[model samples]
Target: MGSLDELIRDLRRFDRRKEVTNALARKVREPVPPVRKKIRKRAIEVLPSSGGFGRWVSKLSITAAVKLQGRAAGIKLKGRRKGFPDKQPKVDLRRIDQGRAAAPSWGRRGEGDWHFQTVTPGFFTETTAEADEWRKAAVSAVDEALGVIRRG
Candidate 1:
């Protein structure tokens, strides 16, 4: 029969090897963050005539809206600041006018106005699989450690 000291030594060696293997496996199965996706504007529109003036207004409105949204989303605006001798540096006001004109008598008799819409995109990932795997591995490791201790 094996000596008590030899048996204890063998059990300790087996437990150490199991722990190292479990740790390595856990590292290999670790989850990583997903990459961010690009946001794209879906659609844009401008009211009033479809003439050159309307086209210009539409372009301006779309540009303004996109810039505004980007700024609100924490994007840095491209420009230099202005400073007065007695005042702090300030951002220059950027403006885009949506041109409006009076409708022809043949149509409505009121002043024409412009309208537009904006959109923002985002990215995401599901963590169900990663969570499940982590839980299973953690439970298994704990159970194995407990078994080893109980046997000792």
Candidate 2:
């Protein structure tokens, strides 16, 4: 039979993996903020949570080593269904301190201004540049978690 210490070590490994997943997801989504305005004027204000890309990306799940998969994709990301009976697509805006009721002027009803635009290629370059740093931080966090396990 495995010792109690072995079980504890296994649990710590699982925790570390979860932490790494979160870190990777954060890194993947880091570009959304800056890319928002570039993608469209007032994109940060008009769209909930910078087009809801950041929030969607933040929900990314660990699919592979040091990598993640999320709902935000293509030129558009269909968000969660909202409204009691209407069941309309919801935009997550907690990141920007605004709710659906505060849609931007362009986003108001009857505006007919909602259009899709692709993210600039430069955004990917800028975000990937910092990937190493994010990874390092995640590694550090894992080390800390493991250290705590060891001490305990």
Pick the lDDT winner: 2
TM-score for each model: 0.21, 0.29
State, as a TM-score between 0 and 1, how close model 1 is to the true structure. 0.21
Q: 16 in model 1: Cα distance from truth in Å?
A: 7.6
Write one digit per residue (lDDT tens) for candidate 2, span 70-148.
3331112111323223322453322222322323345544334344333323222233344454444444544544454
User: In model 1, what is the error at residue 102, expressed in angstroms?
Assistant: 44
In model 2, which regions exceed 4 Å deviation?
1-9, 12-113, 121-129
Clash pairs, model 1 backbone: none
Best by TM-score: 2
Alpha-carbon shift of residue 62 in model 1 (angstroms): 39
Determine which window of 10 residues in candidate 1 has minimal summed lDDT: 34-43
Candidate 1 lDDT tens digits, 8-34: 344455646555435534432342111
